[model samples]
Target: MNEMEIVADRGAWRAGFEERVLAGYRAAGCSEPLARALLERAAKGIDDWTVATDGTEWTAVGVTQENGAAVGRIHDLTAPQGRAWAERWCAGQGAQRVEVRLTGGAGAFADYPVRGQNRMRAAAERPELPPGLTVRRLTEEEYPGWYAGEEAAYIADIVRAGALTPEQAKEKSDHDFALHLPQGYLTPGHAFYAMEADGQVIGTGWVNHGFLPGVTFGFSLEVYEEHRGKGYGRAAMAVGEWATRRGGDEVMMFNVFGGNEVAMGLYDSTGFAVLDEFRFMEL
Candidate 1:
């Protein structure tokens, strides 16, 4: 596994990197689409590459790669050769901080690591997810509401953690908000379930379909703080799992901040296991 010798064009580089990462992920018996999604996100603004000598795989983002110094998340990095190649490449680019992020089945190097890992210290405990809360697929018409809920949940958590002032929160929350659901981003059959009590939405969960051939990605569960203790998270997750499996997805996956104990506990109780450990090293 020597460094890639022939650099590829931007699109070609992304595809090549994704293919190699997916191969590694599938070899590990992980989902392919999930791995692809992570790679797509990493390709957002990346440029530069170190082609592998064998011409089969390449180190897509090297130290000499300059796509801006902002935080970057790599979807997967199963190839030790590629990872080592990237390490050397980034070192040459004067990368002050580099994080090798592995998500789904792909991997990438980040110029800046996620700062402060203390936000989710009070991990939500796994409550007994209740029953009788009707869960169903989300209609296109309901996407707006779902998006709002997702934003609100994220904003609320950030505020609760004292990570941002109200003004800062609003500004940060509004940036590229529409990107949450770009056209053709998620399939209609993708599941988005809401827990209703008295005909009102109390909790919500959803799964995003993967870009790879057969993987299904699950995430975006938001239970109002008021509804936190009554087992809603578990219930929502159970519904989500059912929906994911119903969609022909064999494995379901989601990411929780390391400090989020409550979500971790809930997922653990529902038979979810930690597949990998990723750290956010800041510059």
Candidate 2:
């Protein structure tokens, strides 16, 4: 395949790119507000390092240098030829590995050895909670400890996935909590919950009703260590979907880091479909 030339018409390229990003998310059932936010975050840091064709293809590439190794992130790549060009370009730019975020579907990129992050969604419907399983809102006293533990675990997951360094993860963790839960346990659109089965605490989860307009977002769903393999995760999901529908939302969505096969399998078997993916390939 011939290498794609650098696109000089940045204005037109950006407009088309933004349109595709929005269309992909909307087609995956995201509301207009959520789609726009995704587009804004995706298009924030394009520089001269990007590669594109004048027609319908573009890849905005960002390179990060950490611990003397260069890693590349390629966004919105549209074709097999474009992928080929991006690999060569990134390798030439000293990137040891490249992570590509693709919208719509993987198509030809399916053979890549590694996957990064994914956004998954399912239609919201009230579900019957497993027998003896119940959920209750976390008390103000419980919120602080829950939030701290959850934040640490989340930061660890992203860092392990190579999506961010420790420093970057900490910064993002602080910013996300400040933005999403500014009022702690009383945040109007956010709810934190503890799950109990037969009066024994088994897990905790949280959800946000305002982030995606008409969609309810599950920020976290965790079953404690001793509670695994007993269908508690599924039970927690049932509670979340019930809460989502009770709040009048029609769709439920959440993000999970790649390589978490157990979590991915649970989500998939419970009717969640992947809407977007960041696929990783070692150069």
Candidate 3:
């Protein structure tokens, strides 16, 4: 437990971390087909805070904070070895407790903070677009409203999932939207839009064609509070599928945090299959 190294580069020590990671996700509930490229992306661009054991190979991937506490993920590692690596990493971090996420076959590292679950979903077939509803590219003028609603929804979501307090959620959501959302829908390879019926903006949504080549991901679909229960959200998802298909894709994927049965029900109603459930633990 004293000298294990945890480095990045997707944990090259493992032959098939992606498959093993997907297996873990599957064991947790994800039904959507995950690609190695996606997991590979997760391993890139974090060398400074990363760990490297013996420099002979990488056993895990994580970052060390200013406090010397290591926090990140380990993939395709067995329990006994993973446990040892974790304890050693914590010691190296000069931390009494190191928080890490385990993928592949390793289970919980005994008493840790259980981050809530996220349910992954996917639908390859487009749903029927509700009659009289339409979607259009988001205009510059509506960006303000869209950002506000998205941040509010984001805060509510994480708070509900117990990942953040209301205050922290607000701050993080604010920061995230600024970093992730565009000023308008002019970005190539991504599409964002507003759903209108008779020229009224009932909701907003977006589809990321960049998620995977020819494959689209429904990033967000939110119907206004007042518009709830009128089937507007469902229509938005259908439009999301249509947009993905327009990009030459037959499927779309998304996730709903655990406890959002309303969203789970809606995805089911729209013909999306529950693919997996993903959770995190903080040690």
The regions of model 2 sitting more than 4 angstroms off are 11-16, 30-41, 45-51, 54-57, 63-71, 88-97, 111-116, 122-125, 162-175
* Candidate 1 lDDT over residue span 1-283, tens digit each: 3445544444655666667656644554554564455456545545533444335544445342223343323333435566555555555656644554453422343433322221111112332335557765556788787787777766654454433455655666666344444542264545676677657677777666542344445657777678788777776766555655566655556656544667767776766654444554433
Ranking by lDDT: 2, 3, 1
Clashing pairs in model 2, backbone N/Cα/C closer than 3 A: none
Instruction: TM-score for candidate 2, please give it.
Output: 0.80
The models' CA-based lDDT, in order, is 0.53, 0.76, 0.60
- Quote the positional error of residue 116 for candidate 3 in Å: 6.6
Better of 2 and 3 by TM-score: 2
* Weakest ten-residue segment in model 3 by summed lDDT: 112-121
Clashes of each: 18, 0, 10
TM-score of each model, paired residue for residue = 0.57, 0.80, 0.68
Instruction: Say which prediction, candidate 1 or candidate 2, comes out ahead on TM-score.
Output: 2
TM-score of candidate 1 to 2 decimals: 0.57
Candidate 2 on 1-283: residue-level lDDT in tens?
4457776667877777788889988897777887887777677676545757735566666677744568877776665577777778889889988876777667767866344545555554556678889888888899878988899988887777665679877887888888888888888988888999868889998988856666788888889889999989888888878768766787777888766878878887987877778777778
Candidate 3, residue 31: the lDDT equals 38
